[model samples]
Target: MNIDFEINIYHEDYHNAGSASSEIKKYLTQLGLNPKFIRKIVISSYEAEMNIVIHSLGGKLKLDIIGNHIILTSIDKGPGIRDIKMALTEGFSTASKKVREMGFGAGMGLPNMKKNSDKFEIKSSPKGTIVRLSWVIE
Candidate 1:
């Protein structure tokens, strides 16, 4: 069975930061996915959602279940990353002081997202950014 889920994420929507990831968790639970796998998915989803909320203008989190594989994607609209390499490093973030005061930006989001996924890819430009994370269920 193939399934797809998508959620729109708004910029600086701190109150609703993890909603998308929660929805993903609910759906994964309903689908009877293994708890271990679900944990990874949820962690990645939360990180992705938080990144979109804190960093981008706006974006969408898309989850696709194709047979035994799963793909989770984040597509944001504009004001992209200036340095992919630095962004991937832990403790490297461009979060505003206000955002940091809220304890939401530790610069670990991208690194955690990539670490939790079986496969990860990120592309960014002045226009936008896209992150794709994939996992295969055994």
Candidate 2:
């Protein structure tokens, strides 16, 4: 079975940050994905969504579910990552003070997403940023 979804991003919208992930989780549950896989997908998707909301002015999230695998793509039109290596680290952040005050700027988003996904790739430039995360269910 295959499933696909897309979500819009808005600036400073923490309230709607996890909406896309929630929709994806609902779809995965209806499709009968195992509990463990569903949790992994939800966590990774939420991380990706939060990154877009915190780092970018606006963007979109795309999800593709293929059989036992889930693929998530997050694209943003922001300042882009200056250092992919540093961004992937566990405790590096470029978030603003306001974002930090919200208790969400610990910089664990990318690292946690990578940890939960079977495959992760990040591409960024002055133009924008694109992140792809994939997980395989047993």
Every candidate's lDDT: 0.94, 0.87
In model 1, which residue pairs have backbone atoms overlapping below 3 Å?
A: none
For model 2, what is the error of residue 120's alpha carbon versus the real structure, in angstroms, after optimal superposition? 0.4
Poorest 10 consecutive residues by lDDT, candidate 2: 3-12
Best by TM-score: 1
- Going through the candidates in the order shown, the clash numbers are 0, 0
Per-residue lDDT of 135 in model 2: 80
Error of 2 at 3 (Å): 2.1
Q: What is the TM-score of each candidate against the true structure?
A: 0.97, 0.94
User: Given candidate 1, what's the lDDT at residue 14?
Assistant: 85
Look at candidate 2 and tell me the lDDT of residue 84.
Answer: 93
Off by over 4 Å in 1: none
